[model samples]
Target: MTDWAAFTGFTGLVLVVLLSFAYVSRGVPHGDGASVSFDDNPDRETSLDGSRNDVELDGDELVSAATTENVVDGVSSTPIVPTPDSAAVSSDLPTHLLIANVAVSQALLGAFLALGAWYAEIPSAALGISAGDVPTKLGVGLALGLGLYAANRVGSSLSRQFGFTPDEALRESLTPESRAGWVLLLFVALPLIAGFEELLFRGALVGAVAVGFDVSPWLMAAVSSAAFGAGHSAQGRLGIVVTGLLGFVLAAAFVLTQSLLVVVVAHYLVNALEFVGNELFGW
Candidate 1:
């Protein structure tokens, strides 16, 4: 018999490495760098009249000042503020690339896992990949997704009240400027993310470990959920904790219903609601 646990574990590792490379290559900075700040300099500042006097540096000290029209080295002395078109292009490029990379990678990974399951001779039903009651599953998923969203809102409020700053990376990713980008995120990337993660964690990892080790399903769920949380380490401590708890709930739902569709829908709804809330209400 093949060591299914090892196979699934290796697959998960590869996915993480690929995703991390994509993120880093796109210069998607995490933590403090995710947000734009304008508080570095207090002495060299703009005036209240929306204009600035350019200062000439002499041995690292300001020696003289001139108006915006003053020329320096045969070039215009005015500060070049980015045009709206230029700014949009610069911002949209990274966001588009990141979303595309995630969506494509996840779709491919989900397909690969399905093929692996077939090759391993695992029954589809055993892996919770079979179709069940569609309407009921969707309803349950929507309800659970809303519940999680509400809980997350409350948690965020409490965190703010306690002086904990929110995750800037998350906030940036959810707020897209272009309508096309937002549509792709909601319809393409979110589903791919949900499908791939659920298939990997709840389906492949849990199923393989349960069969290979002859362990209880719940134990496998817990172990796989932990791995799921670890995969989200880029989101920081609170993100990992909240994602872990959500993964646990998803695992339990899988165990109860034996339907991958249910969990995928639930996960997608959760992400969708998060983006919508963030965009509409600044949640």
Candidate 2:
């Protein structure tokens, strides 16, 4: 009775447009430079006590001085210097705004999924949301998460060796510039991202397609994983491929455990670890 094909198509189209917009906006240069550069100008030098004595200006344009330490909250802070050509606009979104956006998006997704499940007459268990063996599901999910992370690392290393650059969009969005950014990433962004993605791709999309078409679960997994990868177009070609493969693994886990909790935990761990490694260790 459910028009699963139409539903899947519409969802895929919406995701594609949103991802494309995110990618294109990041690609557009915010100012007049492709990159930022810092240079030394003797006239703008700091004193021996790490204090600037002169405020340098060029044609009414304020020049950001070289790195200076500023104490904030009783800790030494690295002054964010503007680029030689253009001022550095803070890429970090306000914490409250970011959290509110994520919360609203997740709430909308939850509502959509609920409606879809009802329309399809699909049992909650079939969508991997019903209560199950919690301990076993968590264990399997954690193991899969670790394995996926290792695979991603190896793949990334290989890509770098082949002259692959990191995705600018992802870097801009995920890399935190302040303590507040880190808190939002860890506490808000990561969980909502993981939960909503797994629910949509693995739980809703795969389940509906499989039920509506009477196709094998593997086939539905393939379809949904492709959409998942497509949603990451900002990450470039190799990123899409790698993400697609990883999506399949998550889908497989969802199928095996028949528990959304397992896949959500695994997805959360993977994203959290990636952000932490990138932020703390520059990996």
Candidate 3:
């Protein structure tokens, strides 16, 4: 039988070195290299389709071309007012679905990693709907949450520094009902999902790799986090960067919390606040 333990340790160490090198290299100045930042502004550019011009201009509103809002002036003096071209709507609809597929792909990649570890006989490779070490598991979940949020801040800062707007994920559709569905999907899905992720990635993988290889715990954590980031490729370049940053945060959390207690709490709290806005209402 393959010494799965030894193999994992070796893999973890290799990943640590690779990711560390990449992380450091990012700081090195390449000739003519410029940093791009995230533009919180959703409407910085005009659509080439002249969609904005057609929109009922209310004092020349600078609109993002991505918006589905009707651009033709409702009160045009012309006998036949121009309507938003069907082509524009058709082109945009596909793009929206494409972005969503990307996000889903990243998430699935993470799941694949967990399954791989299980096949290798790695303990704690994944958290079953029920798993050992309940308190520890919860702590890990919290760590994942805070780690992700911190990663988000770092990635946004990097985006701003680089002067690039990360591609926004295409929303499925613009509808009150769809929006509500999305909210339910995330709020209802994320807590359990997040918990499972932490258990598998931070708790199991990190711990197994660390023990298997007899490497430094910190190194093991770092390697797992890098894998976490890479798994998020479907999120696009920006998503990968964000995942990488969060991976670092999770690594730190695992190391510090040691029991996964605080990690889960932190994770749950961050998700609730960021997505559900429950924290804002003191929930």
TM-score: which candidate is best? Answer: 1
lDDT of 1 by residue, 75-123 (tens): 1111100011212222444666656656776777677767766666666
TM-score of 3: 0.46
Instruction: Please give, for residues 153-255, the per-residue lDDT of candidate 3 as tens digits.
Output: 4554465465544322211111113564455435444444455456555666666556655668788677766676654332344445455555567667766
lDDT of 2 by residue, 8-121 (tens): 655565455445544443332211122112325545433211234555565435333221111111110111000110011123344345444554555565566566567656
Better of 1 and 2 by TM-score: 1
Top candidate (lDDT): 1
Ranking by lDDT: 1, 2, 3
Worst 10 residues of 1 by lDDT: 75-84
Report RMSD (Å) for each prediction in the order shown.
11.6, 10.8, 13.2
Error of 3 at 194 (Å): 1.4
Candidate 1 backbone collisions, by pair: none
